[model samples]
Target: MVRISGEAVELANEGSLPAQEVPQTSITRSQAVKLYISHALSTWNARGYEFATILFTASAYPDTLVAAAIRMTIVYFAMILFSSVVGRWVQKSPNRLRTLLATIFVNRASVLAGAFFWLLILSQEDLIGSEGRFSLAKNDTLKHILFVVAMSFGIIERLSASGNLISMERDWVVTVAAPSGRPYDLTHLNAVMRRIDLVCKLISPILISVVISALDSVRIGVVYTALTSMVSIPIEAISARRVWDDNPSLRVPKEVPPEGETPPLQSGTMSWRTQLRQYLHDSKMYFSTTVWIPSMALAMLYFNVITWRATFITYLINVGYSLNTITIARTIGSLFEISSTVATPRGVEYLGKSYRSVPQDEHESEVGLVSGEDSQSVRDTRTLVGLQRFGLWGFTWQVFNTAPVVVALFAITAPRVQDGGINVFASRMVDRAADYTLPAPPVGWSIVLFSFLAISRFGVWIYDLTTQQLTQTLVPSHQRSSFAGVETSMMNIVQLFAGGAAIAYPKTDQFVYLASASFVVVVLSWLMYASWVYRQRGHLVHWEKLGQGLFVGGR
Candidate 1:
């Protein structure tokens, strides 16, 4: 007779999968506090930005704000050169805290020193000007110097913040999910994203507008931004620990990344060529050098000129609306639309788990097998497949995809900028109150432009949300920090060039140019929608769910 003993019971239990495995990572709460100081170093918002706006509108020269641009360029150049060096210097070293401490010192401590010295400078200026012994020239120089120093610290911190966050996010995500099994299913992970999006959508627009306005104002904006970072960074860093539970995978860095390896390639928008380029390339500046390689080698490569037009138009619409509203709104909206599993815990349980893994034989479906042994691999692979295909949008979001187009826009308009600029044609008419004794023609023109912009904001809001999500989801988690940071750099770079173009831009027929661009952008939308469908056409599994089981519902 077969007799079961305590040893048999122990053996049987040992054979079973874990009830729950929660893992904790080494990126501890203390380290998280230090990591965020980089934000203060990296952001370089100049004081008196409103003043600069007025000056730029009235004057002919590159203002002190442009100096802020130069400083940003220098900082990034240093960051690009030094990131790996910094990465190495701190890699597995106890002195990683030293780097964080140094950034903090430069950002927070140096401000006190500069403030004291600048107060002396201001005292001298006051005495000299009061005595009628000073020129506006002396005061301007001192003011500019003080402003640049404060902003430089800000820029350095912002750069460090981006790198710091990326590092934390990567490590934290892996640690949190380590207990689930061989492969983590993102569908199970991102389901909670919907609530986040909903909350963000409703809350962000208002909060962001306040944030931007406060950031734009005097003295208060800088302090507010620094304080916000202090709070937000710590929270973000700590939240990662919750994901990993009961897994042996949680601890210090190991030989392997948690998500494991990429599966062998099947069909994807990413060609072998693009993959090779992305893998081997350093300094994402080189990313674009290869997009043309495939096009040239292929017999038929069609250009989507309309898509390009639509994107620019979309971008215009985005900024045309209250940028503060769009920035926060879009961020929250994108967060919400992301798969609930990837975003929330309750979302995962509700959307992902089968109430009964063993379904009725008559109701047995392809999904029923998701709980089986072999089924894990298939489900995991499908999620990865779905995740990886997002690289198409990723491909578009990267430097190689966007640089040439922006450079071309700059090149086209760079020659015509004249001194004092074209007065932002629409702004010229709108800034003056309608009742404030303006010419009849000007009043009428202002009304039309404002009306147009008001109607356009809604469309712009939608596009902004879509594009932000596309950027976030399309990228691999490992590379997203640098990639997202690069977008900011691209915006700054474009604006710098655009500033010069704006200076030279003549006022003649300004509305004509604006209207034409806007019209072209709207018309191109349908075509862009078509291209999205075209790229998605061949994927057999990518289908819209038509019935109850087809649609994913979150908790």
Candidate 2:
């Protein structure tokens, strides 16, 4: 017997398998409200602080591009290396909320430490001297020491921030939504959370840009960043605490024992070798799960280099597109992404409801059509069916929309390079009056690419939200963090490859090969995802029915 919102639903029994009970749990409207507020403030502060610190680092260093690259490398490496550690820690923790707070404190504290060290280095003005036309610091040893310490703390901050996000977004959100037993609530929450993130993504960088523009000294920007981080600590902490206390579900997670705790390996502590072995074991388990299909699909999408990425912006610039044109185009793309976040919940609900209306007899015959115990009860309830059905819909929709991007990528022709300092061009283009005049020549082609890219953002985010919800709902509670951590690392690993692709063909004229390679990668990703979707077709709502219901019936 299971109790959800005071209604009882008897679960069917499986032969030879022990049954698990569903507890009576509910998430009230007030709890949901507070959770949203807390999540919003916490995410905004973290993202803003991160963007500000990156901006400060870029401005502080003598070689801007190198600094940016190094910072990105450090951040991604930290995420890849430590995300699993945090996941395992959270997975085995007695108090998950405490773990969340621990991450937040460490993240904020590290920001402060990094900023302080940077300030020390920047304040040594007398030690700074000119090297050719550029101002270079002369106290090599002290400067190097400070720089290294600052970056080291930066690594710590990134590690903790990743953990914090894993806790709040990946772990807690699912935990909180579970009690309601409604996929719509889960979809709604996921959409709102993503909306917050996208909002920050759109606004935070621009604010950092403003701070960089207004401040005469890089040191001032560093100070401002430190202060902002300091302020966030209390706000994030207090709000997170309130959310935890208000929602009991968020506080209690089933504690799984730390891996490699056998008598031989567990003499109170394990060695590094044992830890590595344990991580590998966990990775193997994560990759073997049914959810890994969509996880890998999502990760592979990051491999496609066709979007409004920085590389694309540079390509446009090298091909004679004005910075204003690129900025406006990217902003338009972002707006479309934001719209997806807004629309995802409705999309999920629409599909969910339509799928629910299909006769049980229609779905019952094919339930458990997938070769796993997981899909056995897919039609036992509306919730179970909705999970995979909408996920497939969103996944297939995005892949269809990506067709335009493939065309856009192949549409781009080899560019004739333009000679100018990127920094000078960026600065002048930002303040320069907008040229409403129609773009001529190569710039026109770039616009076509940007237009298709903008349109695709809507589908991309819809797919993202659906896949996220699917992962959250399908994976068991205790394993969610571990799976998510490893999944994040996988995404970053693929991203590193994407970055390598850019490095391999960096010249403007070489973009054609890059584009060609990207197209191939996109096709590969689509094949993988499409094949999986096809395999699950028997377990899913008919595409013709779903389409007619969504667009024609407006249900």
Candidate 3:
């Protein structure tokens, strides 16, 4: 029997069989709520712009995805286990305020630490990229080893914390809405806001670079970029508090209930586990009708595209530069700020709000449905955020590789094109936009090849969200962390394997082929999401299905 969730795609699968009335609603909420959600999802441009630049300029060969994945999994599991042990230590003390204060302090510290860590990570990457002469000194080897290790740890921590910080935005938006006034559920206005957020994300880096260029140096931009993480942490942290502690929706009064009365428990008592359980239980309703099938499978496929292309860039870059010989205080600024820039167009609500605070009024439907400011936001955010998961990895590798791609493509496509950053960089100007124009690179359809890579990735983003949500909905909450952990671990594995492929290939062509494998896997993964998820919509299959699909496709 056909199910409800996947009905949209299933109907599409019939391929123009007949035009039947498919019911959809418009005018679900006020313009403001839609605006907020759209803003939050708008980071694609910022991230994509960075990827464009990185791909255009990149130079490193990739590492082994298998090795990197395994290492990352091990580290994360260890950290999770450790957090369980130490979280209590930090939370100690009977006073709830004090406990919250302590937790907030750690939260603040993480953001600060993240900034510095991020700086170091970017600097190391720049070192290997900018260092010329293509040397492999003893020092270079040591630095390479250290750079990988640092990046692994640094990214893990940065990403993990960053995820939580972003989540606060989801949670806080729910906390602040006015009661009795619910926003419409699916407004295009939300999408419009998302576009704005992206504008900010894309333009900020170039703006920062312009300032640095004015000084004829990259270091000032880098330092300023790194230091700004300090500002971001607090802003986001308070936003988180608002959601957790201050949200009117989640807030509970301390007054004792009457003997005949009952009230909702405060968030202090409810757990992520409980929230997770309820989510899973409700997901059973839509398992058969999931629309995420194509998008999910595509995501895995796109990851592969990025692997070989970006990795090849990294390997070549490392070969030419010694880690310590190069400096990149400017790039760090571009890295983190880009997210904020992208997020702006996605949602104005995301822009003005922080993840810590939630002051939204709770509007409970007479029937028992809990839909409000954040719920719709969360739903849309989950759907769109997948577009950006690769921002860090893709942006760093791709934008950094831009010069070479242009040169290579120009070489192949326009055979006589001279290769070099100055030349290739200058050619990037559609208008005399870049006053400090570089020389042009000969031949290789650099633009065409890179465009294919980006378009494929964008398709994957659209696919992953639908499937991820459906899967998350079907699974139980207690199992989500483990599920999430496994999924995350698998992604790490993919990256590790890509890295290995980058190194093993004797030539760039072979490496690119290896990268194609990622896309192949992604396509296959989506097929499964669509077919299997559609087939089992109304019943529970072996939880084992998930094990096989965990890392099937991702970017």
Candidate number with greatest lDDT = 2
Models ranked on lDDT? 2, 3, 1
Query: What TM-scores do the predictions have?
Result: 0.44, 0.81, 0.46
Encode model 1's per-residue lDDT on 481-527: one tens digit a residue. Answer: 33433343443343343333333432433323433443343334433
lDDT of 2 by residue, 191-250 (tens): 878888888777876776677678656667777777877876777677777777877665
Clashes of each: 47, 0, 138
- True lDDT of residue 35, candidate 2: 68
Q: 2 or 3, which is superior by lDDT?
A: 2
RMSD of 3: 15.7
Name the runs in model 1 displaced over 4 angstroms: 1-138, 178-217, 220-250, 254-281, 284-373, 385-555
Number of the candidate with higher TM-score, 1 or 3: 3
RMSD of each: 13.6, 7.0, 15.7
Best-to-worst order by TM-score is 2, 3, 1
Clashing pairs in 2: none
Give the alpha-carbon lDDT of every model.
0.33, 0.64, 0.35
